[model samples]
Target: MDKAEKDQQDDSQDKMVLESVSGRRLSYDMKTPFYGDCRDVDDFKKLNRVGEGTYGVVYRVNDTKTGRICALKRIRMEGETDGLPLSSLREIMILKRMRNRNIVNVTDVAVGPQLESIFLVMEYCEQDMGTLMDAVPTPYTPSEVKCLMLQLLEGLNYCHKNYIIHRDLKLSNLLLTREGILKIGKLKFPDAQHQTHGIDLIVLFAADFGLARTLSFPSKPMTPKVVTLWYRAPELLYGDAHYTTAVDMWSVGCIFGELMKHKPLLPGNTEQKEIELIVNLIGSPSDAIWPGYSKLPFAKTLNIPKQEYVRVYMQSKPESFFHHTENAPLLSSFNNLKLEFPRATEHTLSLLSGLLTYNPKARLNVKQALRHPYFIESPRPLDPSLLPTYPEIRNQVSEKEKNRRAHDEERKKRLAHEGNDSIFSADHYKKRRKD
Candidate 1:
């Protein structure tokens, strides 16, 4: 009785163990495996997490195979029960087709243990302009600004000529290297939307094509919900889906202004505020100026307050600012822009005025902006090598540090205006700390 009972118990236990092992193996095998060109992500040694955004998580990695430092962006595809994300597929296709010094180069593609993970291997740039701008202790000289602007325009012009439109262009998306070369970042192409090329004081290259849309002929209507609010074109803001390359031109203009001012030209918090800020600066749009301004979707639906140009000018500066007692005809003829951007040269102002015009049709295209008198004027843009060099950006600042810096600047501006502690200063500081 004892020998037969013991043998039967041992057999049952062995069968149960085998069943558990088989179940574990089946669950593991259910995960998708990479069948693409490069199958092993282990080929690269990940150094650190450099960036994270809507599309993917970026890591600074060393490619063991090539002995090179590169950025590896791991596309977030958790929800997909199907295949690779279409956005990632478009980015891969676009980058593979692009070969330019001004564009960030995709070196290779790698997959993790399962097809669940995908990574894009790109040539690494030291840091992006947003990080640099917040950390750099100095401002760019006019000549240096020109060189950077020229490079950006060159990259963008090349992209446009190739029929790609960069729907999103902002300070944060523009990256720069230690040697002062710019490369665009975060290229997350829009669905059915297509994309450029450009950068900052460092030689600029157009990065990110994620939100980029291909420019179609006989121009089809595309979504207006592209480009960051501050850098977005008026046509986009006004809900003009049939917008053209002029949308990009407006962003270039904003970037140009940012370079000159060393801060965002229009940091509107909302769509209404953005349009209001624009109208306040350039005056309201009209058929006389914009030709088809009234036909926009926003025009038909939104209650756009009629803005008076002279009133806005007076709000920012004294009415007498434009009036001159010494009536030298040229001095009296000077417009309101001189008062707004006191540091800008006449030629620079001329270019800004053209680029920042109310009418998209009237805005300066890349070639037109490149040919503007500002670039050809007396203080020509110096060669990139000759641009002033600065130390590398400080170890990346935390969000708290950025907020504190912003609040400190606001406090200083308020103190300058009122010569006392403003009522909301304490509350504002508290809010910033919380943020």
Candidate 2:
């Protein structure tokens, strides 16, 4: 009786241990093995395709188990016969390691029936800043802009402090919730949404990490063609491979200008045009202001416009003033940032200028930018909870609606052009009348 009972008990305990191991493996793993172990992708039902990017397709999905809403990103495996793409692996690894309120949270990894199809489950955000900006008729107010920018910088600061460089930082990559929280994701909120008191409630998360890279000592060279064309930094456009976190600062500056202007600050269609735009706005770069500027790979090749700064003497000071004037270049040719942002306060323009400084070394880092006076001035940054709300334009606008809007804009332009023409100027109209 003793031998039979002992043998049966041992076998039952072994089965329980195996079952426990299987359950734990399927739940969460610190190592995050991409294959096998994860829950099947079938557990979530796709609500709609939210957006698509270079590395993956995003969908708003409903967790069938908990009835929770989440964003499912299907990693692009299109030519990846060998294994998961290195970019995807990096994104997963970086995201899983970092946890910040302003950063998009990767909750779990779900696997499809086939190994090739994998998805990242993340918290659902209702809107992305890019789409929201386009849909809204008005630009963000100063306080509101401050609220958004503060969260962005906080998240970015976290990334830089942790030695991570977000190679790409742009509006589309910044996500927001219905409650006025700004999230700084590579991707929040409630009846408190109607209140003006909960500044802590609003948040901005930095989303897409596909282009992010961990900074190493004596920073290594990375691909210069990493960030989106509009938000790409000057160093990148100049083909500076051994760049630093300053590239991200330049992007943040561009984003700041976009928020103020309600459009891209330097929306050049070509690389050459982009450089020209930068030169025109901030003035051309030279060794005097930005040391080693001439040494940039493309500096000599690009036909950067040369604007001479001539000092005008007041004649009241006589020869003494003249001597100083002859050698000193005027500040006029340096930058026309004031003309561009005529309504911006002195502190605001100062912050923008600091961030957009030609020399990456001179540019403001996240911490410095956060401490700028623009944030502490009157009508200080609005609390996230008090931030205004807008329609979920990204989710609501369809391809057909977008096309229709484009057609309407085109029609309006055509009508406006015709209205300005002389009554009988058109040959086509004359011919039709003759017929």
Candidate 3:
């Protein structure tokens, strides 16, 4: 079933008694055939392929029953695997618990009848932010940029609240609906939605929870799940495994800077060079202000002693900030973009600064981060009803509506229960051997 169906069921189940009221009795019949693993899902015809990801291919499918439009993420089997992959299971688990405008929602998941593929049904999104950013030629106004930042912060705030951290927060992960509503499109957010934001009419959304992780109450250091090189945060460069939600906050800061500059602030190819580029743009780490700098795994190898470096990189040449809009105030480098985007005003910047601070301890927690002026004082407020939207979203909702979370869970457990026999497992050697 799809997400909407599951929600309706969940709503009804909320009122139902937890005690068991029904049980299935196994009976042998001469004519009745027992369909178990041999009988897979026999629903929903395959439609056009939409996109591909690290694990599978996405298709724009039509639900035969409701004639609904939905995006189906098909999980490929690695041959003879009876169950689903852990990534697929986790994605289902996370999507089930997550309900927000900025996060992508899963509506349905079904196994192919032949056990050939698994399908993930989600709200059909038109485009991704990265594609839109490249496709849309009109530059963003300061107000528009603020609108986007507020939505992203709000979404991030939600994840932090739930102890979840989206490690892969990049442009490609944001998506957009056809009508321009940022439906947590691509990484997540619409291309052009006139969302009510105080005096403005624009909103942004954060998408892609594939790389997200949850922390415990006290929070513990996590694995170095670094995003792409361009969006990698500073602490990750130092090999800090015991990081907190601050790591995601740093990602937010990086994305905020990009929204303003229309370019990646610190685009590095290697860990060493990445730090070198960051230190060049924001200046290298200093023990004086960043006391624990020298102790970092990478910091101990700094060639420069005393760390007397400029805020901007020593090699970076000062350049005038381009005005994307006419009659707009001049933007000083990215360091001061918060000034240009009111949503990123002083308090917001301060909060973001803490996230990007050389010292992780100085970073803001989820609660503290949301309290930042960017979110608290922003003119635009997050409204959930303004979600799953796009020009086509409403039309697609009727047919696409199913409880994807529950369906995903069933498929996930089925996949897990099957283990190595699961087709979702990756095999780099497949093509080589086939050739």
Candidate 4:
């Protein structure tokens, strides 16, 4: 064939491809469907931003073709940048693999010029647990608390079965939907190739996927970083290299306490400060409760300023920091010294104490935690759909942790089919599912 004839055929294929100016390689942007494509701003016009979290800013959007309104999370890039942010990539990778009614849903992704800033499109929700907690005239009612807790535990359980852990779990991180479903978000950071803060971090949020590692059967020594310092378990406190899901359980306990009391039980300003509070309340750990604490890589050099080692620092803080207050209406007249659940159910207090236990092995994990009396005989069953007041937040699909989400989603499907919806769609995340 003549060059003129060959050029005509090449033009047809080149119409859909882009030849790199520097290299011989070619790349395809997307395959077009019957719906006509556009290079104009009408494709997706940005509305006002609804919320902003640690990693990026989120904006409400209008999808031109379907006229559907969705959320667009545009994470800020550092320099030209460290590629895609781990949190954004991790959420995408994990959410795509996980499918369940309870976990936040991730619908699509969009990229800006030269992939300058990656944009994630997600389902839209109106509120989060943190905002709701403040909205309600009353904190969570006994029944509402029971419902939220059940779902939270179940979701955590599902994640555990898949060998995934949400180091950052809090009320503010929970998204409540118009449908009344409560989901979690922000699961991708730890595994990001480019990340900051690892072993010596003060808390679990800092212990993002960037610090995440797999657990071997025989087990290997791990670090103390992963979960936030205040939510950290005692096993980790004493520095256990061979930590497991118990680390997360400890954070659950702290979060539970906050939900019940409307405040953090061990509200240490820093990891070191939090450790002292845990130790002061629980009185430090021994080998019995957390078997291999002494063997952890950081254990040999645990740096908490114990009273015995640093008496001056011990005298500085006030004791009222750990005091609990009730969820009911109160004034200056009500005693601040009382426990939040002043007349809290015996089992309720027991469940709280059990999880808040300093020792890792002894800490109530998701499995055993599910059996806790708090869920079995609480005032109500866990059901996110029941709560009317707390709003919900939607999750973007482009975060990391994609590899582990498949196992998590499969387990969620099994649980939902068995009628345990709350377990998979509970309170936490902060990446509960897709946020």
Largest TM-score belongs to which candidate? 2
Task: Find the candidate with the highest lDDT and give its number.
Answer: 2
Instruction: Output the worst ten-in-a-row residue range by lDDT, candidate 4.
Output: 328-337
- What are the root-mean-square deviations of the candidates from the true structure over C-alphas? 16.1, 14.7, 15.5, 18.5
Write the candidate numbers in order of decreasing lDDT: 2, 1, 4, 3
For candidate 1, give the lDDT.
0.65
Query: Model 1 residue 150 lDDT?
Result: 83
lDDT of each: 0.65, 0.70, 0.52, 0.54
lDDT of 1 at 41: 72
lDDT, candidate 2, 1-435, per-residue tens: 699997886676444323323332234332322222345578999989988765578899999988999998876655546444333433453465567788777776676545466677888888889888888879899999899999999888988887777787888888898777777666310111111222221112123553666665666566698677778888898899898889998899999999999999989899998888887788778888778888989999988887542222221322321243332221212257778999887667767877877778767778777876678887799989897787767678678989998986675566556764645334444455479
- Which residue runs does candidate 2 get wrong by more than 4 Å? 1-37, 85-93, 187-207, 308-334, 397-435
Worst 10 residues of 2 by lDDT: 188-197
List the lowest-lDDT window of 10 residues for candidate 3. 17-26
- Per-prediction TM-score to the true structure, in the order listed: 0.71, 0.74, 0.61, 0.63
lDDT of 1 at 429: 53
Full ranking by TM-score: 2, 1, 4, 3
Tell me the spans in candidate 4 whose CA falls farther than 4 Å from its real position: 1-42, 79-91, 135-137, 190-223, 238-241, 297-342, 390-435
Q: What is the lDDT of residue 361 in candidate 4?
A: 52
Model 1: per-residue lDDT, tens digit, 1-435? 699997886676444323322222122122212212342577789887787777677888888877888888876655555445433443464565566666677766666545456677788877777777777757788887888788778777876777777778787877777676666556752322222222110111112453766665567767799899999998899898887777888888788888877888889999998887777676677776677888888876755667654311111222232233221111111245566679887667666666776676667677777766577777888876675555545336679999999988887567556633665565555576589
Instruction: Write candidate 4's Cα lDDT for 1-435 as tens digits.
Output: 899987875674444222211122222244323111213223578876777755567778888856887767764554533354433343354444555555555565455444444555666657766666665556667777777777677776766676655656666656667766766554433333333333222121221122333334565455555566667776665655567777777777777777777766777786667767766554454455446656655566666543321111121211232123121111111111124457776556556655665455555567665665556564666466667653232333324556467767676666556653454543332135657
Each prediction's total of clashing residue pairs, residues at least 3 apart in sequence or on different chains, is 21, 18, 43, 43
